[model samples]
Target: MKRPQTVRSRGQRAGLDLDQIVETAQSFEVEDLTMQSLAKAMQVDRKALNYYVKDREALLTILAHKAFADEFSPDAIRAAEDWRDASRIYASSFVERALSLGKLSEHLWFGEPLTTWSLEANESLFARFFEAGFTDEAATRLVTMLSTLCLGHARDVIQATGSMEKPRPKALRAALERLNPEKFANLLRILDHGYDTYGDEQIDFSIDVFLVGAEAVLKRDLRR
Candidate 1:
């Protein structure tokens, strides 16, 4: 495999350049890498790297964009045509991807500085949800809730149990099953009638509840 070299000639001379730094950062990530080690491997002076990037934070953002841009698979999410269905697919796919990447996923998604590209992708996903009849506020809240739930659950499962490789698809399927519209309606019924539910006593389930409530609210307003 030909290792891609960062362009370092002619038009740019910003001390190893952003491309080289980003490429080096990505290579480091692939090799279970670190920034200190990246500096060593790239053979660029630390001061030069400091001059090129603000700090490790900048380097990490570049690496995350590269990783997501190159490696993230949207096959699962793309299969669902409806916005609600797509949200389920997206959550599961993201969790699976995070599990595959292990610590790298955490570093990419949660580590500091953050990637604008990843943030924009998230914003776009929620925007799609809004376009599909959900209000902007509802869409944002729902996306935030689901993202936190799924990503945190994935991190817990993978990091603590070391079960990173998409543990029996059924696992994620079961989680998504909770978000079915009918099931959601049932929860609303329980809440309306003042009944308590058992198991998974966390805010993770709140998104499903909120989705149901939001849909009902929208329908009511539209009818009025």
Candidate 2:
């Protein structure tokens, strides 16, 4: 077997631009991507990709950073009218982006390399909460709660829709019908009304509930 020549520069190689690899990987579900596969798509040998990315983990980390930075941009949060608005915008955007990434959402949420950057971005958003009269403790707790809510909702959306693809209405209805009504009365009732899909409405509801609760707590604390 002949050895493949390494591309020395970060310019275009085999139709793959070094700069576009991360964005290209974002087009596929995280689990579906690998250096070998991506290189194949780029019409380059896998070794050629090494010139740009060291390995799969590094590639994934880059994608995670891009996704997080885009959604959690400090400027976007700063432009919000208030802490509540900032929280709403951040949570909604984060959930939607994560959901779009499918299995890759796990890497973004739990990956260790991105932790410092995540915390720094979140801290910027937390400052908005503090500026809105929330004590440090209150602001931290509220931001933590909102993050948990958004992550949980994103996970639910992934599982419900089966990997960011469109919902299989027939398959979903069949699964719901298989559950015993006696044990899952509420679920059955929900399915009966054709509310088989979890979507933006659920995300909005969770955010609204959290914001309302946070407001009540802040008001009570102010009164004390």
TM-score of 2: 0.63
Stretches off by above 4 angstroms in model 1 are 1-14, 29-34, 73-79, 109-114, 119-124, 163-217, 220-224
Tens-digit per-residue lDDT, 1-224, candidate 1: 99998776332443477777776666554555555676787775566667666666566656655565454445544455766667666665556555676565555554444444455446556656766766766676667677777667666665556443334343544555677656566545544463222113422364466567657856764675
**Error at 34, model 1, angstroms:** 4.4
Per-residue lDDT of 67-177 in model 2, one digit per residue for the tens? 766655566777889888888877976777677766666666553554655565576688888887888888878887888888887877777664443355556667777
The stretch of ten residues in a row with the least summed lDDT in candidate 2 is 161-170
Report the CA-based lDDT of candidate 2 relative to the real structure.
Answer: 0.73
Once fitted onto the true fold, the runs of candidate 2 whose alpha carbons sit more than 4 angstroms away are 1-62, 110-113, 119-121, 162-184
**lDDT of each candidate versus the true structure:** 0.58, 0.73
Task: Report the poorest 10 consecutive residues by lDDT, candidate 1.
Answer: 195-204
Q: Against the correct fold, how does model 1 do in TM-score?
A: 0.59
